[model samples]
Target chain A: MIRLERRKEPSTFWRVANPFLAVILTMLAGGMMFVALGKDPVTAIRLIFFDPIFSAQFGSYSRPQLLIKSAPLILIAVGLAIGFKANIWNIGAEGQYIMGALFGAGVALAFFPLQGWYIFPLMILAGAFGGFLWAMIPAILKTRFNTNEILVSLLLVYVAERILAAMALGLMRNPDQPGFPGSRDLRRYESAHNAELIAGTGLHWGVVAALVAVIFAYVMMTRHMLGFHVRLAGQAPRAARFAGVAPARLVVICLGIAGALAGLAGMFEVSGPGGQVRIEFAVGYGFTAIIVAFLGRLHPIGIVLAGLLLGLTYIGGELAQMMLGLPSASIQVFQGMLLFFLLALDFQTNYRIRLREEVRR
Target chain B: MILGSINPAVLLAALMVAATPILLAAIGELVVEKSGVLNLGVEGMMIIGAVTGFVIAVNTSSALVGFIGAALGGMVLSLLFALLTQVLMTNHVASGLALTLFGLGLSALIGQGYVGVTPPRTPKLDLGWLSEIPFLGRALFSHDIMVYLTIALVAGVWLFLSHTRAGMILRAVGENHDAAHALGYHVKRVRTLAIMFGGACAGLGGAYLSLIRVPQWTEGMTVGAGWIALALVVFASWRPWRAMAGAYLFGGVVVLQLNLQAAGVRIPVEYLSMSPYLITIMVLAIISSGKARGSLNAPGSLNRPFHASN
Candidate 1:
């Protein structure tokens, strides 16, 4: 028989090791799934986990794509980690991201045919503000009415999706192409474009913002009174209240920061890589960021590393889809498996397994 | 007045059809929550059931077998959750979310080949004399077996929770697991069974969508029904009969919105489509805020992980 003994202190070794262990487990399980799909599991696994970063065939092209993909994930995850620290769940980052894109794109479209150096910067602020505004719904509702944030925030994602469809079909539709339901390609709009800061390197303002967010989060978490209160609130709500942490204020602050950062990610994405406010504008970055937060163990620097790793999978999953005729959903299943293993292995950090004999009473 | 173009009988019938999926899913969740476990994976389990039921029904040419397959499929997925949260000691909320992501991906993969393929038809019950009963016949008796089964299940659940010895024990576990455990009850076992039953019901709900409602396997087809069902539990205040009422009410909104869109009632299609979700949020706020006593109905150990150390 096996018994689990709770540890007084979580094992630091296991905390560091479990994520890597989870990754390995996900690979083995994912390979088996590929085999079930009637494909060569070995090649599938190699392509998804290794080929993108190591192979000569796909590495160079996929390398830059990795940073592009990870940027938004890292940025959004940084904000989510803060709210999660305070035991506040804001799973509606996807909705916030959508609203941010709409707001940012609205600015550019309103300034159509105009050229100004300040336009892009103004759009960035608009994007952040849009996300903050969307997030404030749940924040205000939760603070005022004592509603559940998770359901309220998540419900808004569907609402946001509908609004996005409306914009694509009506408000934001490109007049230049009458029948096409999309906005003017912002990439070709020189004045409002989020062009590469450096040629061929995929370095953009979004990457820089992600890095700044990382550094800022690291500083705030390590050296701020609010950070202390956040941790205290998550660990002990009653104690935190006694220590003068206003739960309502913290809810607003955490949701605001998360909303702004997610909005910024959405803004940078629309301005740079995405370049259009279409029906499919909001991908699953907001939801994926939740996984990124946990895989990184809710730490700032760890989120960066975790984001890059998931980013690699995104590029590699695409590559695998192209090369092996693998279905795109396989990658989603792969990410889900990765999360499962991560959660399952987390047991190791807080408890130790011991083999023992059962004694009958 | 704007609803003049719509037929009340047809709309009421459509409401029953639309409400079945959420009603079935919510009733099962009611049991799970009553047993003190919160599984936010109703969406995931439903989709898995949808795909599995579709696949099995298509291959076997039997809708009944398809539903059984869907329930089994959902049970298997919830077992994974039980393993994670119960045996492996993972966080319930995180595990539930992971289950959803995994379920969506897995279902898509399984459903790739089955897309656009038609499954066998599910037949409605023939209540001979009741079939000719005016408007009530079309709105109520016209549904297939699952509709009556769902209502029966709701009544069954109410009886099970309030009348039976097992029901009392389950509620006891939900109200306070530590006390239940001290009283020599198997809290984990009771919870696991409740979770499995929930999965089966959610799966049946999904199969109902694929087999009777939309009657097709579309990717991400359940939309936000699962989440809405989760909210329904709160709206019903954890009472089974109230959950049925809440489901029908929400379903009425959906049918009304669709009818309005079809009637071209001047409202944008997008706004009409978004009304259900917005209404849900409004209802949640009102219910949660107005009845301070309502919070007491939530199981005391709803989301808490339980471990028995001998």
Candidate 2:
């Protein structure tokens, strides 16, 4: 019989190795799923995992799309990881993101037909502010009224979506295109446009912001006192309180930072790839970022890598849908499997498995 | 005149149908919480159930069999959660979140084939002469079997948690797992069973949505109903009867808002659509702000993974 024995301290080797192991396991599971769908598992896996990066046919187009897809995910995940580190769940980043897009779009629309050098920077600020303001609803409620942030944040997502739909259909609707439910395409607008920074590389201001956020998070997590407090709070609340770490303050700060980052991502998306404040403006990026945060082991650098990996899956999954006749939902299931295996195999980091016969009577 | 157009009996009947899915899911979560496990994957499980029930009912043409399929699908999905948190000792919150992601994806994938397909009609209960009786009969007895089943489950859960010896043991296990373990109670087993029951109920709730509520298969038919159910459990303070009441109240709000919208009320459609979520958050805040801690009655061991050995 096999038995698991608890370890005094978590295994450092397993801590690092488990994520890689989980990826391999997910690939295998995904292969089986493909086979079940009456496709050749090997070709499907190869197309999804390898072809996007290496193949001459799809790689050029997909490689650029990878960065485009990952930028917002990385940016959002970086903020989420900060709050998650303090055990403050901010599941409503999606709402913050939508609000940010609206706020940024609202600014651009307010200055419609006006040419100004300051427009872009002002829109960015408004986007961040909008997200931060939306995030405060749950943060204040949680800190003051002791409400659960998870539920409050999540509920806000639905509210935000409704607001987004309203904006697309009513207030933000493009007057030029009567009867259509979408705003002016910001990409076509000069001052507010978040144009690609480099030719054909998918490198935009949002990508730069994501990179900066990653570096900023890395520095804060490893070299700052607040980071220490966040870690301490998550690990032990009582001990943190004794150490003079204020829980409410931490909650607010974490939520604020996360909201701002998510909002910035949304603003960038709406002005660049998304093009307008449409009905489906808020996709599952906010929710997917949660998975990215955990998959990255809540580390800034790890999150950067996780974001790119997940981004690849998004591109590759689309490719599969188009090329292999695979269903779109398969990619979601594939991503879910990664988290499931990661969590399941995390057991190895904290415990040792042994044969039952090895135990002393 | 707007109020005059709305019949009280019809509104009440609509409210009960709207409430049944959430009521079923919340009561299941109530038992899970009472046994000291907080399974946040209700949304995921419910979605999975929704797809499974829809697919089976479409193929088999029996709503009863569809519900059973949904329950089993939910239970099977939740077994993964139980294995991860209960056996592997993973974090409940993270695992639960992952479960939701997985369930949503899985359901969407399975539902691809069933999209736009109308489900076999779930027959409403025939109370014979009782149906002729006025407002009470039409409002209470006219719902399909699942609606009545949901009400019965609430009573059953109340009795199981408050009066039965098994219920006492489940509560004891949740209150303090270590002490219960010392008393030779199987903590993991009890919690696992509770988790499975919660999953089944979530699935049944999902099935109801597909089979009777919406009565059609859509990619994401549940649309945060699971989250509402989760909020309802907290608002009810983990009591089965209160969960039912909270569900009904939410349902009433939903029905009222939709009716008002249809009647050309001045309120924006978006605002009306968002009222249920907004009100839920408001109620949660109010309850939590009270002198009593919102989660005071929460099982002491809730969210803490149990391990038999050090």
Candidate 3:
């Protein structure tokens, strides 16, 4: 029988290898699921894992969609990863995302029928501020009252959803479309629209922001004192305290940054691909970003790649659903499996397995 | 006359029904936390239980079997968690989050064909003569057997945690796993069992939602009930009786808000829809700020993964 033995230092090999192994395992498991659902597992798996990138028919269209989807995910996850590094959980980025969209849309709507360059920049600032303010509720509560951030952040998501619905139905509804429960299509407004920076490519302000965030995060994580404190805080709280890291301040700053980034993602999506504020505007990006954060091993650069990979799954999962008649829920299951296997395999990084003869006393 | 027409007995009955799922889940989580394991996958497990119960109940035409299936499904899911956190010694928070996502997806996959299908109705308790009591009977005694079971489970949990030797060991493990291990207790084993028990209760809660409350299968019908249950456990300060009370209070809010919406009260439906979560958070903030010792009651090893080795 094999037994796991503790290791003095975590294995660097497995630390890098586990995510790759988990991906393979998820494919095997997901393929079986597809087979059970009466679909050709090979074709189904191909569509999900490979076709979006390689298939001639889908590749041209799907390629652009991948970047479009990955931008917000990467942006949100970058912020989340930083906070998670500090052992601060900001599970309510989804709520902050919604509020950001609302705030950005509010600014755009306020300047309806007007043309100005300042409007977009102003909306971006407002959107980030909106998310920041929303995140502060949990941060302040946690710092002052010592409440759990996880529950508070998550609960705020439901509240934010309700507010989003209210805006779609009431305050933010497009005046021209008298009966529709959606705000004006920001895509149609020239000054307010977050249009593509490059023709035929999916390059937009959001994509630029995501790249900038990634580079900034990479630099901060590698070279900054705050980053060292965050890593120190997570690894050893008492040591961090002795080293003069104020836990409360770190909590607020980490959460604030995460919230702002998530808000920017929301604002970008609303102006870019999402086009307008609607009841269903907050698609599960905030939630999905959690997976991105972890799969990237909380590394900024790794997060970008993970975001794109997950984005492929989203596009490919949809393709499989349409072409192979697979259930949409299968994708969610597939994503969950990735995390499960990664966590399970993470055991190997910290321990070694050995086979030993039965010990006879 | 108008106030009288808004019958308190009916409102109380609805409140109990609303509370049962959360109460069951919270009490189960209380035990898990008491054993030094925190499983945040309650929502995932509950939804899985819901779908499993719904599918089984629809196919077998038996609510009892449905609940069994739900419990099994939840336990099975929790076992994955046990393996990850207990055996592999992974991060509890990450593993729990993964479990929730997995449960939601798995339930949806299993529930694909069962969408819009009605579940076999769970029978309300028939206490013959006792049912004839004017107000109390209808409010308290008229619920489906799960409601009574939930109440009994709370009492059982309270007794188990406070009085029994096994309960003491579990609490000791939660308080300080290293010390408990030094005393020759199997910390991992105790935690695994606690996680499974929590999973089973969350399953029952999910089953109750599908078979008794909503009485139908719907994707994401559990919504955020599992999260609410998690919050309730904290609001209760990990106490069984207090958990039940928190559940009832939350249930009361839910029932009241729905009633207000149905009665066409002047408040926006969106605000009413969000009231329960907002109220829970507000209450949580208030309770947390009141006393430092209150939060300290949380088991020391609550979210920490334990390994026999250093």
Candidate 4:
């Protein structure tokens, strides 16, 4: 029988190879799922994995969408990766995202018809602050009252959805369209609009922010003292304490950063692609970012690549939905499978499977 | 009579029904936590159970078979979690989250064709004389079998954990897996079984929602009931009876808020709708703050991954 033997140190080769292996495993499993669903597995796989980027008909439209879809994922994942490294879980990024959109849009609407450069920057600040404020609830509770941040944050997501619904239906409803439950289109508001920076490339301010965040995170993880503390805290909590690393302070900082970034992602999405604060404004980007962070191995550069890969699936999944009569939920299942495989494969890095004779058992 | 518009007996009965699902899930989770494993995928498992139960009930026209199928469905999904967290020794939090995501997607896929369809009705227990007794009967005795089963389950869990040797062993493993392992107990096996029990309970609770509460299939239903159940376990301080009390308290709040909305009370509908979650946060804070040093009654080895080494 095969037994797992612990490694003295994590294997570098498997650390890199396992993600690829997980992806291949996901593809095979996802193909089987498609077969079970009564679809041609090969065609479904090709459509989801290949046709989005390779097909001449859809490639042009989808290639740009890749950036649009990935920008929020990368931005949110970068911040989340930092917190996850510190063993602080902020499961309420979705709430923070909603609050951020609400805050940013509130500013835009409050200063309606205002055409100043400062308005957009002010909205950006409000967006980050909104997310930061929302996140502080769990952070303060965890720090001061010893409450579990994970459950608190997760519960807040539902609360945030309610607030989002309220805003759409009452507070931020477009007056011109009395019956409609949405805010005025931000795209038409030139000053507040997070317009594409380059034509037909899907490069918006959000994408630029995502890139900068990736670079910043890479630098911090490699060079900064706080990043070292974060890693130390996760690896050895006692050692971290002995080194004078304040758990409460780390909790606050990590949750704060994650909230702000997720909020920023929400703000950018609303101003650009989403265009308005509507009842259906949330698109599960916050939740999906968690997968992106894990898929990236919680590393900055890896997150960028992971985000893009996931973005491709989003585009491809849509294409599949339109052409092959596949349900949109399949993509979600596919992503879940990817994460499952990745986690299951992670066992390889810490242990080696070896066949040994029955010794003492 | 208290509120002029709301009937006290009706409110009480509604509260009991409202609390049953979370109560069942919470009791199950309490056991899982007591065994020192935190399975955060209750939401996923519950939804799987909900859809499976609904589909089966609709097809076979029997609520009993639907409930069983739902439990099996949830258990099967949890086995994947058990495999990952137990055998592979993956991070519990991540694995649980993955299970939820996978469950959600899979349930939605399975339930695609079943949406808008009514499930077979769950029969209410016929209590003849008992159900006819004044206001108390309507408030308590007039529920379906599952509600009584859930209450009995809580009592059974309490009895099992306190008096049974196997339960003692399970608790011992949860409190200190290494120590339990040293004492010749299979910590992993115990936890794996405990996790499956949690899954099965969550499934039954979910089936109650689809087959009895709503009696129809809907995508992404049970919005945050699983999370609320999780909170209930914490509020209960890992005690079975306390979990039931917490569930009833939460259920009362939910029913009261809905009643207020129906009566056109002053509070906005949105705020009223969000009250349960906000109240949960407050309750959590209060419960957590009560203990200064560490978590209140939490299993010492909760959320820790165990790998046997010789």
Candidate 5:
């Protein structure tokens, strides 16, 4: 009987091809899910994967929307990918994102009615600082106390969400609107608003920043010493230690960067499409970014492309929800399936599929 | 309202009831993690358990059957997790996260029909005369059978970890899978079993929420309860007994918050609502200080993937 054996080094061919193979499998499976839901499977599949960027009827508007929607996902995922590469799991980017919005909105709300562009920049900085501060909690705890960062960071998400609710209903409630559980509209604030520079297109500074993040991330992973350390630590922790990569420092750096990026994404969202702070401002983008990071193979360019592809799904998923009566949660399941299949197919990298010999009884 | 002195005793009872779900789930998770599997899908499993238990109980009118259904539902989900992370050697972290996501979606789908449907009440186990004693009876003896079962589970798990041969083997596997594998201990089987056990406990916890606590089905009823259980595990320092204490502490915080709200305390409802989560962070920070010190029982291979080559 043929038996499977692992290679000393992984196959480069399968390393790249697996993701593509997984995507095709996911599409076919996801199409089946749509069909099972009673919609025309082909049209539904095209809507989810193709229509957003290709169909002449929707491509123009959807193309720009793709960039707009992907901004937060790419920025946050790029930061997270570094940590994932280092085997540091920070599952509370959603919390960091909320804290960033809270802090940035606090700044913008403080400077309301002032028509200075500096105010907007200041708010952005504050947002980033807020997320950084929140993230540092887990980082410091993990390094200093040997506490599990996974638990620490993730639990903080609930706290952040509750704080957001408090701010919306109590601290940040609009003075003009009575009994409404939301904050002042940031977009309505002349100086601090993050509106589009071009008409009809949703392109904003946030999208530009995401593109910049992609470039920086690409460089950092390929050329920076820290990136190598991250990869080293994840692949072989003992070997990483031999190379003088400090685990504590790596944890702090990865967490700090991730928190800051998530924070900036929050700030941009609060200023841009999200428009204002509300109890429901968080739409699960932080969690969704994890999928983006993995789907992109944790490669910066791949993350950028993956973020856009995911963005397309978000838009198209909504379209199908309205037009075809498809449940929106299917989109979440579909995203989850992609990760699951991507992981299951990873066996190909190390071991070949072969018929197994019977074990000695 | 009964004109009586402030029922600190009754208040404590509420705390115990509130903490049961977290305690049960965390204690179960503690055992699983001891065997070296980090199953973050507890939240997903719990929610499915919640809905499944609610649906079954509503239809059949039996809390006991509902608990069984919840456990089975959770086990079914765990099977998927086992297939991917154990059999396929996928990254445990990603797979667990995916399991959680799938659980969330599947629960939402399963809960569609059950939303707003009322579940039959979980009958409290009246411990006869012991339950009638002024403070002790009300606070400790009087509760649903599941609550007592949870406390028993904690003690049972604690005993197993400290006293049993199998426990030692399970611990050995978590500490060093390669060595355990060489010793002919079925590492994958142990981890998979632990994961299933954890899933069942999480399902029971979810059932408590639907069948007793809220007594109704909901879309996202378990909300961050699974995450809270995860935090409880760390707070317990991965010890079965300490998990009980942490869950109770968290439960006390929750009960007190609701009490304050009922009393119309001046604090914003949001801050009051956030008290449990905020306290969790504070406690985590305090415990996590000094060194990355985990419990002695914490599995050595907690997040590592095991592979054998001859």
Candidate 6:
């Protein structure tokens, strides 16, 4: 019987190419899923993948949304990738996003009826700071008390959700829409709105910040000492410690960066598209961003492309939902399938599939 | 006078029912972790179980059949994890996350038709004369079969880990897969068994929710129970009995907060609702200092992949 053997070390070519192969497999599987759901799989697939870029009906409207959706995802994923690369798991970005919205929107509401241009910047700063502080709970707990960051971060999401519900229903509820469980529309205000600088093209400040982050992250990974430390810590904890890569500092930096980016994503989202803070404002972006980061292979540019691809699916999934009568869940299942196959294929990159040897009894 | 209003008897019954699901899930997860696999897919698996149990029980009107269906649903989902992490040697963290994501998606897809439909009530089992003994009766005897099963499961699991040879071998594999492999133990097989067991327990927990607690199918109904199970294991510090203690403590906190809300206690609903998670973190902080983190007994290779390469 023919058997494949694992490489002592995976090749660079295989390592980089694995994600692309995984995407292709996911597409094939996704097409099959669409077909199973009784839709014209080809038309659905085209609408999702090809039509967004070239089809006349949607290309104009869809193209701008690409950047709009990708901005927050890229921002959040980039920060998460940094922590993952450093072996620090921050599973509470959803909570950070909620907290960021709470803090940023709180600022705007406090300064309501006053149109100072500087207030927007202040809110942005506070948003980032708020997220950073929430992340610190787990980071500090991990560094000081040896608490599990995974559990700590994960549990905080529930806490944050409760806080969001409270604010929406109680303190931050719009006085005008009495009894409604939602916050004031920050976007309606001149000082708080995060509108596109380039109008219909969807080029907003958040997108610019994301691109800047990608470039800076690329440089950091390729050249900087801190980036080197992050990679080394994940690859070899012993070597990292010996090389004087302080675990405490890395934890704080990774958590802080991730929190800030999630915060920015939250702020931009609330001010731009969502327009108001509500109990369900997050819509699982934080969790979905994890998939984006992995699909990008944790590279900054890769994440941009991955983010756009995922964003297209989001738009396509909604379209399919409306047009084909496909349940909204099919989209989530498709995304889950992508992660499933992506993780399954990661094995081929590292180890070749081989049968075990029989031992003499 | 205050005692007259508290209704300690009813409160005990509610607490027992509330704790059963978490206890079942946390105990299963504790075993899986003790075998050195951190399965974070319990919530997803439990949700699957909840829907599956509801469907089966509603159709068949047999609570036993519902639980059986739940265990089957959970085990099947867990087999995916077993295949990926145990057989393919994929990263446990990523695979566990994928399991949950897939479970969530699949459950939501399958359960869309069942929403707004209530399942048949789980039949409560009476312990004959034992249930007539005042406070003790309500506290321990007047519950569904699953609650007793859950408590018995805790004791059984505790004994299995502390006494049995198979349990010892499983622990050995978790502690050092290579050593276990060298000693002719099928480390993968052992771990796979642990994963299935965990999945079944998670399934029972899920079934308890839909078939007993909520009595209806709802999308994302288990909410964050899986995460709570994960935390409860940590709180228990990986011990089976400690898992029981941790689950009861969490359940009490949840029930108390709900009671406070019902009583119109002046606290904000948000603060009251947030109390459980916040209290868990505080408890984590108190017990987490320096030494007691994750039950000082967590296996060295808890989340590592084992490659049986020559």
lDDT for each candidate structure: 0.91, 0.92, 0.91, 0.91, 0.85, 0.85
Tens digits of lDDT, candidate 3, B39-124: 99999999999999889988999999999999998899999999999889898888989998889988989999988777788887
DockQ of each: 0.84, 0.84, 0.81, 0.83, 0.66, 0.73
Residue-wise C-alpha lDDT for candidate 5, range A249-321, written one tens digit per residue: 9999999999999999999999888888898899888988998998888999889878987888888887677
Candidate 4 chain B, run of 10 with poorest lDDT = B288-297
Give the per-prediction TM-score of chain B: 0.98, 0.98, 0.97, 0.97, 0.95, 0.96
**1 versus 5: better TM-score goes to:** 1
Give TM-scores for every candidate, taking all chains together and pairing residue i with residue i: 0.98, 0.98, 0.98, 0.98, 0.94, 0.96
Q: Whose lDDT is higher: candidate 3's or candidate 6's?
A: 3
Superposed Cα deviation of residue B84, candidate 2 (Å)? 0.9
> What is the overall TM-score of model 4 with all chains considered together?
0.98
Candidate 5 lDDT over B142-202, as tens digits, reads 8989989899999999999889999999899888999999999999899899889999999
Best-matching candidate per lDDT: 2
Give me the displacement of residue A121 in model 3, in angstroms.
Answer: 0.6
Taking every candidate in turn, the Cα RMSD to the unseen true structure, in Å, is 1.5, 1.2, 1.6, 1.5, 2.7, 2.3
For residue A240, model 3's alpha carbon misses the true position, in angstroms, by 0.9
lDDT of 4 by residue, B176-197 (tens): 9999999999999999999999
lDDT of 6 by residue, B1-310 (tens): 3334666777877888888898888999888988889998898899988888888887898878999999999989998999889766677877787788778887888788888876777778878999999898977788888888898899999899889999899889889989999999998889999999999999989999998887788888887888889888877877888888888888888887777777777879888988888888878876777655455767877888887766
Error of 5 at B248 (Å): 1.6
lDDT of 4 by residue, A27-72 (tens): 9999999899889999998988888788898888888899999999
lDDT of prediction 1: 0.91
Q: Which residue pairs of candidate 4 clash? A: none
For candidate 2, list the clashing residue pairs, or say none: none
Question: lDDT by residue for model 1 over B1-95, one digit each (tens)?
Answer: 77787888889889988999999999999999999999999999999999999999999999999999999999999999999988888988889
Off by over 4 Å in 1: A357-361, B290-292
